[model samples]
Target chain A: MPVTENIYEPVKAKLTNIIDESPLIKTLVLVPEKEFSFKTGEFIELTLNGIGEAPFTPSSSPLVKDKLEITVMKAGYVTGKIHQLNIGDVVGIRGPFGKGYPLEKFYGKEVLIVGGGCGFAPIRSLLYKLIAEKEKFKKVIFCYGSKTPKDCIYKTLFKELRNIEKFQVLRSVDMADEPWDETIGVVTVLLDQIKIDINNSLAIVCGPPVMMKFGTIRLLEMGYRETDIYLSMEKNMSCGLGKCGHCMLGDYLVCKDGPVFTYNEIKGLPDIWR
Target chain B: MEITVESLKKITFFKEFDSVTIEKILKISELQEFDVEEKIFDEHQKLIDIFVLLEGKVILGINVPGKGKINLGTIHPGQLFSWSALFPPSISTAYAFADVPVKVLSIKASKIQELVGDNDTFGYKFMKIIGQTLSKRLSDTRFQLINMASV
Candidate 1:
């Protein structure tokens, strides 16, 4: 076994590479000072030394130990600064924290992952994990949406994956233009285009709060049991340890309890999904 | 193109209605087609008919003051579009463009209003579906707005 850094102490990391996903979005490929490991759906707090830290999920596959990746959209202060930083810059990393998607439960069943915008980041991580263990699952349906032709991310990756014989990737844009050949609509609309055996499948939805709500509603209406639906609830997780109450959903701290939760577990908690 | 009760029954939008009733509704409707990228209607245009997509895709967008067109949603097969045509002060709220060659069933607003006036039973069923479409779109649009909010 190799030595690992303390969980609480932030470790140094170097941004080894960068890919411009969109004008406002970038994927930072970093090499952590120590080996890094995170289950699908877990998140990390990236530090800019004195600037501050924000939580993001690694968009790369966990099976790959050589490097880690985080796809960030330039939305807030921390992310805007991240967008401006060069490829060789250094940052701090503090985790593999929080419970991740229940990979064990997904074995031998169909998995449908629906995500929109930057919310698709964590789902991308989970998708890669599932792709690596292809024989374990019966089927995988991934539907992703963006605002426009220019706003979609993972274009190259999706183009490649679509060529694979087994991966089912349905993409839509709120609006599309010339040279765009995919579906045009919110990602949820993709749900209507396919047939899912709701009784034997699970739906993992992570996206804008609004998208999650509607997507869940659509799934429920389609006969998917609430218990089988998993959601990634986004919150301001300042403390990776879950000690901070910033990410609370009633008694559950999103950082400690979940960045990933079954719809049944959180459905009873009022407005947590709101 | 021609629309009959048989064709109308095949559309999910009118699936709930039986042959006789759909036939009544079909008298006021006409089958229309749009080529890719054609403007089905523009924001603020007079809303003369309500359309139900029979095939292909339609993209909806609202024009911003200086930001150009921002897409709001898409219409798929068997889904209803241009609900504003059925309401008062009828005018489009967004621009709908055909993303692919599309076939749609257009029902004249005046004829639909007359039919609804004459049959209270079918009127309720018709209004209910429109209400559901409006509610669903309102909710999806709300999410779109929230997701587009700063940061």
Candidate 2:
């Protein structure tokens, strides 16, 4: 008889650092008892022990095996508890679940990334991977938006991204409470600022639902094929293994089938933006 | 450097116009340039020219009593602004400033009004474009309001 491993069991991870990203968002750096790994867009079920569990995509580089980072916005019960946690506190992590971005498809193509708010967490990880293999892609363009200058995350990362060859970073804020030098309006407006070779490009959108919807529409208008636009869909995923029907979308389960999907794969799915 | 019917056709506001209509527009339009931080228009100022951004950024804001100029949004290339010039009681609603070195196609509003009064078809198409621009700005403003209220 062959022994089977329990899938429900979570690997213990200890909080090592917490960086305040914004007034409402924090990035928790965790050191897992055992090495854990995941692809850039895949999610992990972060357990708060006695409190509860919530699904989050690791914000750290997947190439880094020992330490994982999860950026959390305090929006709900479990996430609120996770925000209150201190350094050295133990938490459980259940997965590196779901499919991530298809890097092979992105090779030899121009990659355009549109992200807003907390959605930058996953894209940041993806950026790390793309930067490591920069020679494979033709170019990378990133457009990001926030409600205000203060709401923007990873403030220092933008400077570093601008310094890299073949990488162009553009940012915008819906409203400028302070002096902001970048483009302003919604994230979609930044699409107009750059010249893209739509015939040889892939557009990736990850943001709040409104941003995602408008970003995808803008990309379509710019002549990108449906198959060339990728979206990160964050649904209410309960069981990351797909046993729970909580994250179902049309005929597919978001957790098992995707957190990342090409727009062509789920265009007519009901209430996808919601 | 030169303002022509062909150049106007490339602008979003004038893209749908016929060559004759664009030529009429060109007769009343001139290329204007502004340095960074230059104030282009002020809220409540009597308007004379309607503008289309040909290049660089423009910041639109309202002057608050104590908080100073509260930037509502930015105007990107190929966008129309100061449309208040087209209506009666032509008073600017928001102050416009160049956030970067900028170039714009400034059209005499009085000439455009005369053109609209003479040609109904031109009037309808031109007004339709302005209406669409207003609708998009309204939607963008509403989205910003919701974002301000959200977590």
Candidate 3:
């Protein structure tokens, strides 16, 4: 993981707009200093001046390169600085580091996407690609969960997204208060609401670690083969390269081999969903 | 409320029962309809009857401190609700309400035990289905509880 020019260089980008997704998250629209291209499931390092840098996936579509969208949640360190930034501010964008989701495998089959909280960031990249090439896939079902109506991200786009033919999007919140009449419960509840052809389908899951762990178990019980399910494993990516050693899960660097791995590939690995 | 053998067979809870058994079960069961927003059962209600959803949706909800009403899960078509009837001192653990116009087949708990006692085979088969559904619900509930507690 030497500083190779291709992987080490950071392209400059400017935040054109800021969207308040939740009280804690801001969706930043970036216009890169140069042309950029990356597939879904990959992430870029967002560097904020002297404050430092952290890894974040572009929640925007991979097909759209003119402006990239990164849904940044205020966790602790680097993200806190990002929340303070205003529009017209500039930041650094690095490698679409790591393997993007394997859309090639999903080309001819039905696809199930299960995401929770900010995990929707990477899944959104994959979702937009499927929408772009709708005819290539059989069916696409998206099951998303948020803590509440106020915490749901991408609310503005999902209404238009549901209009895609042969696609279904099911949303659930942990609790319902006012003016909310849709489903209420964990996102996995959507699995019961929708019917999937387990034999001919693939499930792509990303979310809080607990959701991933339990969601995997539920999918297994529902008869989905372990080989057909994919998970996004986002360990700490300090370098966005294999050199960091900080994001290691077994011998694999989450930044290098994944961000995406089939359940069969890492089933027995320790601390996988921890 | 119309209770027929065919209708009973359509219910997931009674799917394993034979037509004769289903016919007999229907004698002890009654068809129930719930209008939208109607509360079919309340939490901690003392009852020994379980419901099988035939049409529409029922939301099983529990009140969470600081969080208001959190849905335990959904009881979809062919799914069972008020499963406490199968256990002693049965009491509803959550409130069930019609999310939409709904129909269900209700079977009394005492009648279930009598039927099981009459046919050992039916008892085993009946309990097996209940166990599977209950365990799956337990697992999902445990997961949801963890998620809620974690937050």
Q: Which candidate is the best by DockQ?
A: 2
The digit string of per-residue lDDT tens for model 2 on A1-274 reads 0011556788898999999999989999999988888888999989887888888988889899999999999998999999899998999998888999999999999999999999999999999999999999999999999988998999999999999999999999987878899877888778877888999999999999888887888789789999999999987789887888999999989989999999999999999998
Q: Identify the leading candidate in terms of lDDT.
A: 2
Q: For residues A1-274, write the lDDT of model 1, one tens digit per residue.
A: 1124566678788999999988888999999877878788888888897788999888999887668899998888988899888978999887878889989898888889888888878988888888788799888888998877788888887976687656789988765543466776667778877767778899999887778888888889879999999999867688877787888887889988898998988988878755
**What's the i-RMS of each model?**
2.8, 1.6, 2.1
User: Mind giving the per-residue lDDT tens digits that candidate 2 earns over B1-151?
Assistant: 7777787788777778899989888888889999999999999999999999999999998887997878887898889999999998999999999999999999999999999999999999989989987876776776677776774
* DockQ score for model 1: 0.37
- What clash pairs does model 3 have? none
- lDDT (0 to 1) per candidate: 0.83, 0.89, 0.84
True contacts kept of 2: 0.54
Q: What TM value does model 1 have?
A: 0.86
The CAPRI classification for model 1 reads as acceptable
Q: What are the runs in model 3 whose C-alpha is more than 4 Å off?
A: A1-6, B1-3, B64-70
Collision pairs in model 1: none
